[model samples]
Target: MNKKLKNLVKESYNNGQLDQETVVYIAARLSRKDLKHYISLLKQEEAKHEVLVTSAEKLSSEDVGKIQKLYPGMNVIHSVDKSMINGVRIVENNKEYEINLNRTFHDIIGFLSTHD
Candidate 1:
């Protein structure tokens, strides 16, 4: 039954007619457990690459636009963290790019420790 539903979802998506009505109809036919599994599978199939930006303050529209341009096709989720101090940290697909003052300070401390 799950396999049948998987195939149906795949076919429907491929046919480009998997709309809200079709989703409601399919969901109505699924058991609670099956619905959860189906939704997870669907998410995997239609997963959008995400870019998460965390900063001490909210980014300006221009800054957000620049970030979006750098990571085209990715869904950006911005958040604020006072601990960041300044600058922003970008996280995408489990990879992190830190450009915050706190991180820089930490890096400098680590470097000095290693040198001394």
Candidate 2:
């Protein structure tokens, strides 16, 4: 993680939002990583948007990459969503993903987050 991101996580940790173990995990997970490390910024942005991602969503590292790629400026928290067919439901930038397919895409959470 870069200085800015490291600081943000520190701030969140200080605020008691993020835990130390998670911090250590993040540092180790993002070690020697560029794009993966940038996900911290995206995660921080999600907190700002009031969208929670721990209500049963299962976000994988690959899914995180996919969400970041689809909405580069948005932070997505993955969980087990039982409502959508298969896709992300994002709630960021005051706008949502415009996915209109009906093939059970696994990116609905990226959209549901917006509706909420």
Cα lDDT of all candidates, in order? 0.81, 0.54
- The parts of candidate 1 lying over 4 Å away from their true place are 1-18, 42-50, 107-115
lDDT digits (tens) for residues 55-109 of candidate 2? 2246778866765676554446555554553455565555555332333343576
lDDT by residue (34-113, candidate 1, tens digit) is 88888876775554367889989988999999999999877899999998799888887667888888878999999999
TM-score (all chains, Cα) for each model: 0.62, 0.30
Please name the candidate that would achieve the greatest TM-score relative to the true structure: 1
Model 2 is weakest, by summed lDDT over 10 consecutive residues, at 97-106
**Model 2, backbone clash pairs (residues 3+ apart or across chains), number:** 24
Ten-residue segment with the worst summed lDDT in candidate 1?
Answer: 11-20
lDDT measured at residue 73 in model 2 versus the true structure, 0 to 100 = 46
